[model samples]
Target: MNANIIIECKDLGKQYKTPEGERVIIERMDLAVKENEFVVLFGPGQCGKTTMIRLLSGLEQPDRGAVRINGKRIQGPGPDRGVVYQTISLFPWLTVMGNVEYGPKVRGIAKKERREKAQHYIELVGLKGFENTYPVKLSGGMKQRVGIARAYCNEPVVMFMDEPFGALDAQTRYLMQEELAQIWEKEQRTVIFVTNNIEEALYLADRIIVMRNCPSSIKREYEIDLPRPRNYVDPEFLRLRKEITGIMDKTL
Candidate 1:
C-alpha cells in the first residue's frame, strides 16, 4: 500500500447462498482510499455498494481477500472506522446528547469529558439547540445529522456512509448534501460514501468510483476537480453526469 493510503482492499470477493442458487455480489474488487479523501462509490441499486462499505469498515469479512487500514489488517469493527446509515439508527430512547456520547461513554471516558466532546460534535453538525431532543422529535434530515454527529464523536479515522441521505425528500436531500459538504470541508476525514445519485456524487466526492451491476467491480473512476459547493447545472458537471449515467447498467 502507498504511504498515503489509509484503507485498502485487495482482490476482494463475496458471495451468498440462497434458495435459488449462490449469488455473487462482489468479485476481484480492489481499491485504495487515501487519508482524508472523500471517495464516493456510485452505482445502481443492489450493486454491492453497502457490502463494500461493510467489508472496508470490518462489519463483514470478505471471503477471498483482506482489508487493511493504516498498514494493519482489519479483523472486525473498531473505533477507527465509523458508519452512518440511511436509516439514521439513533437510539430512539436516547437524547441527541446521549446518542452522540454513547461511543465515548462506553469506552470508559469520563462523563464530563464525553459530554464536552459530544457537545462539540452536536454543534458541529448544527444541532446545538437540540441536544436534549429525542430521535422521534427530529426531522428526517436532523436525525441524519445526529447520526453523522454520533459517528464523528467517535473520532474515527475513516467514515463509511451507506446512502445516508437516500431516504430524504428531494429538497431535504439537496440541503443535507450541501451541509455535509460544508461539514466535511471544515473537518476533513477519510470518507467512503455510497450513493446512486450522480449530482450528489459530483458535489461531495474528491473522486467518484462508478460500479457495475450485481457481482460488482469498478466500472470507471472520475477525479472531480470542480470547485467546492458545486453548481448542479455547471456544464462540466452535467457533462460528467450524463456521461457516467450513460455507461451505467440499468436496473429492472
Candidate 2:
C-alpha cells in the first residue's frame, strides 16, 4: 500500500522587502511528503530550505501558491504539525515530565493521562530516569532528546525539524542523528528535515531534495537506495555525494 500523502506544496513562493527592496526567497516550488517518509531538504545557507519548512508548518504564509496537510490547506501552527528547532526550546522551569506534558495539557488531556503520555515518550527517547531533571542540567544530546520527546508527545502527524542537531559538536551531532534515526524507525511519523549538511541528508533521508541558492527552487530530487547504517565512504555513497556536490557548486 502507498503511504498516505501528508503534505503537498504547489507553486510555493515567498518574498521579502528589505532595505534593498523586494527580494525573492522562494519561487515556483512544488513538493510532497508521504506518511512516515523521512525527507531532507538540503542546500547552502540562505537557500530557503527553512522558509519552505515554515510554509509547510503554517508558521509563515507564502506570497503565492498553497500548502496543504492531509488535503486541508495549512494556515497556522497546530498540534498536527510538530516542530523541533536547532535550539532546545524546552521551558527551563519545567521538569522533563512537565515539559513533555505541556502540549497534552493545553490540548485538554487530563493530568493522569498527560503524565502517562509524557512518561512513555521520555522512556522512548532514553530519558526515563531524567524525568525530574531540568533542561539546564542535561547534556546537549540529552536536551535534544527531551525536545524530541516533547514534540512526539502530541503524536503529531508530521514533524518539521530545522537543523535539530546543528548546534551540537561533531560527535554529539552524529550520535543524535543515529538516535533520531532509531526513533524514526519505530514511530515512522512523516518527517521533513531541513539542513545544510549533505552527509546528514544522505544518512537520514528516504528522498533528498536539493534546493538552489537565493530565489530558491528545487534543483534535484534523488531517491537514496543505500541501506540503513550507511557507510559514507561506500563507493555508491561517495558517487552520489560527489554528484550532489557538483550540482550544488553550480548553484553558488
Top-scoring candidate (lDDT): 1
What TM-score does each of the candidates earn?
0.98, 0.96
Residue-wise C-alpha lDDT for candidate 2, range 25-87, written one tens digit per residue? 997788888988899998898788888888889999999999888888988888999999999
Model 1: which ten-residue window has the lowest total lDDT? 243-252
- Candidate 2 weakest ten by summed lDDT: 243-252
**Which ranges of candidate 1 are over 4 A from the true structure?**
none
Q: Report the C-alpha lDDT of model 1 over 185-235, residue by residue, as the tens digit.
A: 999999999999999999999999999999899999999999988999999
In TM-score terms, candidate 2 sits at 0.96
Candidates' RMSD to native? 1.0, 1.8
